[model samples]
Target: MIRVLIADDQSLVRAGFRVLIDSEDDMVVVAEAGDGATAAELTGGTRPDVVLMDIQMPGTDGLEGIRRITADPDLAAVRILILTTFDDDAYAVAGISAGASGFLLKTTAPAQLLHGIRVVAGGEELLAPGLTRRLIARLTTPTPPAVDDTTFADLTAREREVVTLVAEGLSNDEITKRLFISLATAKTHVSRALGKLGARDRAQLVTLAYRHGLVRPD
Candidate 1:
């Protein structure tokens, strides 16, 4: 089962999420916290597979909690998905930079929210292409120097191609179709790329791709 922890300041919000998650046969809410500090503490103790974290909590906040959790080697398997208001794109970017698996608007449909949790728990990045492009572009001011080829010198040309498509927000099935390769091949390429890049997950790979200029904002 995929264990989840809900971290939101509002009791009603936590209760609602608990009910929804408990209804899933393949998932469960193992714990809940009303603040970032408590969330971080529970994560260490419970070691949940996924955390649905509210970005704005009373203290410590989601960003700091994410940082703390991601920094702990013992919690490396935990995936954090930030919950944000519709207009809080900046918070989403910050959460991603701090090692969150992804972010979702609180208004997201129930089906989509469930799917996103599964995706993140299964070690996939869940980004809408347009939103990702915009978020990266907005934060790319005073652009850093393009990542040197040597940085990815370990990856084969085909693997590099696969990584680029992943950064473009394509799913493994999409990559398979785009490259006319088998689904297993696509998955293998992505896995290999992740290993070579030393990325914790696909989201980190996407961030690296952007920072290194493999994928341009435009």
Candidate 2:
């Protein structure tokens, strides 16, 4: 089963999330915290596969908690999905830079929330398409200098192609069709590219690509 931790200041919110997650046969909530600091503590102790973290908490806030958890080498395997009611672009950037896997508006449906948890846990990335486009646009507003080739020196030719396709927002299935590769091959390439670039998820990779001039807004 996929082990999950719910971190939010509101007790009702945690209870609601727990009910939805527990209903899934393939997932379970292993712990819950009302603040980011406690969430970090629970993550270290529970070693949950995924953490649903609220952005606004009484203490240590979500972004700081994300930074702390990700900085720990032993707890690095835990994937953090930021749960927020706000849709501010700067907040999104902050969370992504702090190593959050993805951001989801709290108004999202229960099914979408569950799917996001599974996707992040499976080492895949999840971003709401509209929000994703806005995020890319925000990052590309002031074009940065050209990326040095050395930035991608570690990637093989195939891996570079995969990263380029990912920057174009192609899903694994679409990538497979375009590249004439098997599903598993596409997934492998995506994973390899992420590791080489030190990206936590597709959202981060896309931002990096835009910042490095790997992709551009139309």
Candidate 3:
């Protein structure tokens, strides 16, 4: 089962998420926290597979909580999916930089939310379409540049293609179909590109691609 922890300041939101998550046989809500501090404490205790973190918590705030959890050697394996209403590119970029596995708008459909949890738990990043472009644009500063070619130039030509497709918000399966390659091959290329680029996950890949001119936002 995919164990999940919900950390939102609102009781109603927590309850709604719990019900939606627990309804899935493959998932369960293991704990809930009203603030970032409590959420961090619960994460330490539960060691949940995924954490649904709120962005504006009272104590530490979601960004800090994410940093704390991801930085811990013990809890490094746990994934965090920021649950927030704001779709601010700056906030999302900061969260990704801090090692959050993904970001989900609180208004996300139940199926999408569940899919996000599963994707992050499986050691992948979630970048739902429009948000992907926002993250890239936010991180890409023309003067300074968020990523230098030195970081991305290490990728092979094929791997660069894969990275570009990922930045375009294509999934592994979609990349496979577009490139006429097997699914495993597509995944391998993406993994290699991410490693060479020193990206944490798909989200970072999107940012790196745009920052390096591999892909441009629409």
Candidate 4:
């Protein structure tokens, strides 16, 4: 079973999430917390496979909670998914930078929210399409003239294309259909890019791609 922890300041939100999550036979709610610190504490105790975290809380915010949980060696295996009511993607970028596995809006459909939890728990990246571009845009800045123009020179031509699609939040299967390549080939390209960029997972790969100006926001 995929053990989960619901961390939100609002009791109603937590209760609602619990009901939705527990309804899945493959998942279960191990605990709940009102703040980041408590989330970390319960995480250490419960060691849930995934954490559904809220960005805003009374004392400790979601980003800091993410940082705290990630920094602990004992809790190193925990995966966190940031769920927020706010659309400001700066927090989303910060959360990802702080080691979150994914970001989603609280307004997301119940089905999609459940899918995101499963995605993160399964060690895959989950990014809302709308949030992906804006969040990446926040990470981008003016490129210096002195900077290397061939930012993706290390990646092969096909890998470059694959990474861009990944930054756009396309899954491997979607990439396969788009590129007309086998699913295995698509997965290979993404895996190689992750190794070359020294990214822990696809979430970090998205950030790194944007940092190097790999994908331009529309």
Q: In model 1, what are the clashing residue pairs, if there are any?
A: none
Ranking by TM-score: 2, 1, 3, 4
List residue ranges in candidate 3 displaced over 4 A.
128-130, 142-147
Candidate 4: list runs displaced more than 4 Å: 73-77, 142-159, 179-185
> Which is the better candidate, 3 or 4, if ranked by lDDT?
4
**Which residues of candidate 2, in runs, are more than 4 Å off?**
144-147
Clashes of 2: 0
In model 2, the Cα lDDT at residue 39 comes to: 92
What are the Cα lDDT values of the candidates?
Answer: 0.87, 0.84, 0.81, 0.84
Candidate 1 local lDDT, residue 136: 76
Candidate 2 local lDDT, 94-136, one digit each (tens): 8877788888887899999999999889866666665777767
Query: Could you give me the TM-score of model 3 versus the true structure?
Result: 0.86
Work out the TM-score per prediction.
Answer: 0.92, 0.92, 0.86, 0.83
lDDT of 3 by residue, 1-218 (tens): 99999998899989999999999999999999998788888999999999998888776788888878877779877888987655465666788888787788877899999999999998778865567656666766655444456766778889988888887878888898999999889989987876776666776787667767777656
Error of 4 at 58 (Å): 1.6
**Which is the leading candidate under lDDT?**
1
Cα error, candidate 4, residue 48 (Å): 2.3
Candidate 4 lDDT, tens digit per residue, 1-218?
99999999999989999999999999999999999999988999999999999988889987888989988878867889998655557778898988888888878999999999888887679987777656765777765123234766688889988988988778888999999999889989998987777666688877777777677555
